[model samples]
Target: MTSAFIHLKASRLGRMAAACLAALALAVPAHAEKLPRLVLAGPAAAVSVPLIHMVETGALKEVADSVEFVTWKDPDQLRVLALGGKADFLAMPSNVAANLYNRGQPLKLLNISTWGVLWMVSRDKNLKTLADFRGKEIAMPFRADMPDIVFGLLAERLGMDPKKDFALRYVASPLDAMQLLITRRVDHALLAEPAVSMALRKTKSFPISVVAPDLYRSVDLQQEWGRLFKREARLPQAGITVLGKAMSNDALQAKVMAAYEKSLAWCQKNARQCGEMVAKRIDLLSPEAVADSLAASPLRHVSAAAAREELTFFFQQMLAKNPALVGGKLPDAGFYGNAGRP
Candidate 1:
């Protein structure tokens, strides 16, 4: 009877061990099946239309288990989100990213979202070029924004002190800038796409030039940077990025690139529809403004190679101006995604 009882106890122990192993095997695969959550940070304005398109069209949703968008009225808020790691994905200016990265912020640029959509609109014909704005009042969105920064750089390049040569009126938003320009409250205003287009449309009486208008124009910001540095530095605009802490998995990175590509394609194919969606969401203008803005803005398509080249040029320029833009060190190969060489 003792031998039989011992045999039964040994058999029960063996069965329990096998069941535990099987349970672990099942749980491991279940955990692996879980998807990472993606969060994109940007403003609700036209600058982030592409990102909004990606979410609305389900491109990001198809890759990640969940995706969330955080909107900020100010660009500083977006920068704070990236710095705090509260955002997995973010759309921000290249200069802002460079400043943050230089400050030891761990984030990798994914792709360029838009470029060259800024316009210097002014009613005063005397303000034809950057050099003409001496002791003049200009309305701008915020001091931290790329447009403002670019204007500052332009002023510096033209031998004008940013603090004393020109006076800047900080408008609460892009819309406010447009209003200030239309009502002639401000001498000149720096405007971005859709807002620029909307201002032109609303004030049919005013004529606005496209700033440099030509790629080789003397006042071209990119060309000026290149001339100063004697390097092929292009203006780095806006882009999508991922926090380094959130990009631990190689597979997640690949999915992000794929989603951005898909989203870009979707926006290009449905440009009109996307514009209509934006029009409805912002409640600012007619569908025509949406369509015209997308048509006129050169941010519709970006090849992977072109995007990298643009970023590389931007970094080179920033380094020339201030080496501390990239954390007192230049970005190595790790700062970019593995799509292709720029």
Candidate 2:
């Protein structure tokens, strides 16, 4: 072939190769770098639902070579995970995130995904409000943490002392409180989502029905919070926090938040399927209950920066009740992650 013909051929081949590479890049996720692996941790709650979905669906495959979800059942376990730098991301209570951040843990709040999932389940259907059940025994979980802090503030707002107005039986976790309710050991219990739905579901199912008393999801604390606190009928209770190594990876953090938000939306829209998937991952929860929890929960994804106002309001409320609840003060702006567009 002549020199011009050869040059023309080479140019055509180069264009075709570039087009092929473009198609390949489009077909696969374009990541400049990927972490060898990532661990997403959370409790067996609604906030963690999307994390499990992300792992099962490989939602963060582009950002990391592998992503897995680990369950941290209680605050101690959550602390251990954070302190030990074992988890890259975590689904944690908003207050706990603030506490950790204030205490100098290298972590940042990514987004608040769990808006309102806490509820007061009771055997007494007549109990309509927080005050109505005064002077009665109620099982509470994670005393001085999240739902407890929220309960205390709400009770104080109503001019009723939490410890004096009601018999607050502190339990280790929501599931423990749930068990007490199901077994009729406690007439009322404060439970978060999935647990709340589980209690409602288990009470009616077969052998448990023989002994378990009929329960009612009576007092919605979020509603009570709004009514008494004069705000929206939702609280910034929980969100995902980027921990340890994940905090430094801004691109990965953004991608992770994007995947989490998309996963959360997917879980809400496809509750039944999401429930089954979550059920497989968390043995304590049932598919039916998970689906019900989704319907009942006011789950939303709000970026940390965008949610700062509401979160500050929440932290301020907690701070007023007990300074230790948020590690003695509101976290600096650095506590919030600049990830994912709200």
Candidate 3:
């Protein structure tokens, strides 16, 4: 065909292509960029009770298009989810978060979910302080984890070597340690709530038939931490963190934070109901027992910025004890969120 004829046919085809593109554009939905699914995970602990309540209340419906909430009874499972990039939002021990962040992970702490749940519970009435365990048998669990690390810090602060000053019988798990306590194998145990509450309940059967309030003298180490620091006395325990990918979306972050706080508020307001829900999730204790423990649980939702001083102090203590605890050093300014919203 002649050049002029070929050019005329090409122009007609171009016009037809433009017409088809316009028609397709008009047919497609306006919000075609489907948002990615978000996953929030934590252990089945009281600190995570609020998140569970949030999931139960459909709090994330306002923010997330699709969210999956998964609870693990083991911290290691939660750790894998948090560190392996399997979860978008996760709750983990503050020290683990700090350590991960300091080691150059893109994890950022959103807020403090748990203040301090660790308690020093003992069958001996005289076992009051760290001084009391100078040469007594004590049970410890989850080696190098928060409980073990915290106890080490407490011992060092009390001017005693944990190994030499106290006979700490390390157990495989907190439940194992609690078993030792119930059997009266160890006079003292460093346990977290749920575990503390569980041990207290077991006392009703063995070791003592009569369960008095003073059967096990307990001390809240969060208060002790506050006293030791002489600053923020509350124990800033585990909290929620988001990988860089999830936090890249500012709107999503705000929604997640707000939903979290709202869920936590609802649980705080309806303690008994929340505890029943939590007990169902944990299954280690009854609803009434869980409710009572949840009410007494030292769970809090402090924004990272408001909690910086407390966090820095806590991390510093961990670092002083062992540089590896906080990943050799403290995290940078970016580690703390602008605030886990209002």
Provide the overall lDDT of each model, using Cα atoms, as 2-decimal numbers: 0.65, 0.90, 0.76
Candidate 3's error at 104, in angstroms?
Answer: 2.3
Best by TM-score: 2
Indicate the TM-score of model 3.
0.83
Ranking by lDDT: 2, 3, 1
Q: Evaluated with lDDT, which candidate comes out highest?
A: 2
TM-score of each: 0.74, 0.90, 0.83
The TM-score between candidate 2 and the true structure equals 0.90
lDDT of 2 by residue, 1-342 (tens): 699999999999999999999998976665547777899999999999999999999887777787889999889999999889999998899989999889888899989988888899998899998999899999999977888888888888889999899999999999999999998898999999999999999999988988986899999999998899789999988999987767777988888888888999999999999999999988889999999999999998899999999999998987887788899999998998889888
For TM-score, candidate 1 versus 3, the one ahead is: 3
TM-score of 1: 0.74
Badly placed stretches (over 4 Å) of model 3 are: 1-36, 205-217
Residues 256-282 of candidate 1: C-alpha lDDT, one tens digit per residue: 666666665665667778777667656
Q: Kindly give the number of clashing pairs for every candidate.
A: 1, 0, 2
- In candidate 1 the C-alpha lDDT for residue 232 amounts to 56
